[model samples]
Target: MSELLAIAGLDCSYGEVQVLHGIGLALAKGEVLCLLGRNGAGKTTTLKAIMGLIPATAGSIRLNGRELTGLPAHEVPKAGVAYVPQGRRLFAEMTVAENIEIGLMARGKGKATRDMVLGLFPRLAERLNQRSGTLSGGEQQMLAMARALCLEPEVLLLDEPTEGLMPSMIEKIRETVSKLRGLGVSTILVEQRVEAVLAVADRVAFIENGRNRETMTAAALRADPAAVKRYVGVG
Candidate 1:
């Protein structure tokens, strides 16, 4: 339960427009932390700032006590942080195998990494040569996560992972996340599906108006439905 990643007094902006204010949270080893909020509540911004996709004007991002703030986006992954963005940003023209290979090559890994991911997602194994653009929505999502996993990251940042998926697909993604947790991969999930995230998260943090409003155990949030409704604006 030692801290794997920590954010404190974080602030970021897109040019003159500030989006995050004094945002802070921490993730323990092998734990899943769900970030909940309404649209434009700075949920995605928080993830991006952690990954150095957006520069932080102030504050600290640390992994195992190493400073990560101000690191370039590419360097962030090298620091053991992998990001699966909101949209499944797979290369449309590339095959499933090709897409997975990109991540492996970036990390100086070879077929062993590819075999590992294919083992986690057997469906992808069957369509290695299939064009990513031709795959269904669920398949695309699976590929995005698989690609990130190929990097063998210490911390995974997922943005709206369940968005636009069917019930069965959502369940599959949920099971995959649970499996990852069991394997001791620490994760920060930014999600709108309250119940889905709550089911997988060890803890939950509510963000509002570009700041962290509250953080509590998932069990606590589930026990207090009123708090969930008040902070998340959803029950």
Candidate 2:
């Protein structure tokens, strides 16, 4: 596996108050790397920094060997990084089809592109005419991921994808992620569900007190329950 996304000595702050400290991680092509930690452990901030939602105060962020340190958030997607934020921020008033159209706008205007996205997420095919806000939580999450996929990203940054969903819904998300991995799309999953994270991740990185603590293969973390519980509040 080749390195696709790399963050070295990354740091970020909010108005002089630092939230991340010397955090670093890497994503390989076709791999799923999960970030595990309790709340306020700087998980979201790290994603934001990588996506350029918040500027990095120091260090480097690279995608596919291209330096992405100072790029703006909107430009990050063009560089092959798409972010599916925690809230599943879809346009409530927009129909599912219309919402997907908004996503197509990122890559370019093409009917084939629309077809590709709809094809990937067949569930969205059925709700094309329905308003996004009316969709269930799982469905909305699907829309969010589908919308980002329209950009045709090489790597996806997902934040707490299964946070507030039923077990069945979580299964759907897990299946979707697994399918994406098979298609050669690497992903960085920031999740609170330790079991699910370990189940889907190829590798795991633990972040604590705003810094990288330990990183290991998914198998190792699962085998050591005490290790998982120490940092992520789970075992």
Candidate 3:
């Protein structure tokens, strides 16, 4: 199958401090690829580069055969990529429904998408009118994800969706992501939760010193946690 998204020889820098180096990735339709690395390993930079949030010093980004390099960040979303950053950035002052409404404001998706996102995360339905800032950590994460889903994106890029949630909430996010895959949404997940990420990912990419150290099937990583630990700073 042709890739939904592809990054080849990607390199990035923060000022003169170089970050990502020769990073490459490909995500097929309905497949989830997880990127694992220790802090400062450039995992987030890879995502930013692909989204055009940060300019790539070198490399190519293609979405479904269209060259995306140098496209403005805003235009990248129009090309069918939706990103949920690490912090679960939500409009704190806005209500849950209002927050999701923000996501569709740019795309002009109608009420049907709202209903779809609500159906996928029923908790958000009950909290529709509630202030998003008051939501617990887990609810906020769901709200963040729900907002992204409202876009009905062809490819989803998630950065640490389970970063600080409790174990139960982590499980909920895991199941939600699994359902997204079942729904045929291709995803690239950058996460710190080793066990949680591996559980849902179809394939794994381990990064070390700003490069792709290895790419293997999820089952292979599960069978050999030690290898991942050595690369990602945890087992």
Candidate 4:
């Protein structure tokens, strides 16, 4: 499992307020690393810094040994890193197909890539012409993931992908994550749904006050229920 993404001495801030402090972690090829923490613990901030959505005051972000820090957010995807942000952020007025096309255009991809994503979320295939805003929450999430996949990224950054949804919808999102892992897509998953994310994650990192507090194998966390509860507040 070669390293796919690495962060060292990461520090980020919003204006005068600092968030992340010397955060560091490494993700391996085809591995799923879940970031577990309570709100304001800097989980989302970590993803933003990785994607260059926010400036990292100091640190290194590398993808496949290529430096990615200081790259603009739009260029991040071209470097084989795609972000599925917390809110899904789909174009409300655009049809499902149109939303996917946007991602294809960004990466200079074509119908082949689009078809591959649709294959992963067959529900999106059925609603290709439907407006994204009109779709259910789960459908929107599927579209979001599908759009991100259109880039054929080497590393996918997922921020609370299962935040607001019913049990069935949560299952669907989990299935998608599992499928991505099976397809050998490396991912950094920021999730509050402990069990669901753990099911697909190979490793887990706990964050507090914007610092990485602990990192261990997912199997180890699963084996020790007390650790899961203490770090993530769920088992």
Give one digit per residue, the lDDT tens place, for model 1 in 65-176.
9999988889998889999999879998999999999989778877877888899899999999999999999999999999999889999999999999999999999999
Stretches of model 1 off by over 4 angstroms after superposition: none
Clashing pairs in 3: none
Error of 4 at 177 (Å): 1.2
Candidate 1 global TM-score = 0.98
Q: Summarize candidate 2's per-residue lDDT along 1-235 as a digit string, tens digits.
A: 5689989999999998999999999899889999988889999999999999999999999998899999978899988888999999999999999999998898785788788777777888999999999999999998999998888888998999998998998998898899889888999999988889877999999899899999999999868878788997755
Please list the C-alpha lDDT of all candidates, in the order they appear. 0.91, 0.90, 0.88, 0.90
Model 3 CA lDDT for position 199: 85
lDDT of 3 by residue, 71-181 (tens): 999988878888999888899999998999988875789899988889989988998899999999999999999888877888888999888889999999899888989
Number of colliding residue pairs in each model:
0, 0, 0, 0
Q: Tell me the tens digit of each residue's lDDT in model 4 across 50-78.
A: 88999999999999899999998889999
Candidate 2, superposed: residue stretches over 4 Å from native: none
Candidate 4 wrongly placed segments (more than 4 Å): none
Candidate 2: lDDT over CA atoms?
A: 0.90
Q: Considering lDDT, which of the candidate structures 1 and 2 is the better prediction for this target? A: 1
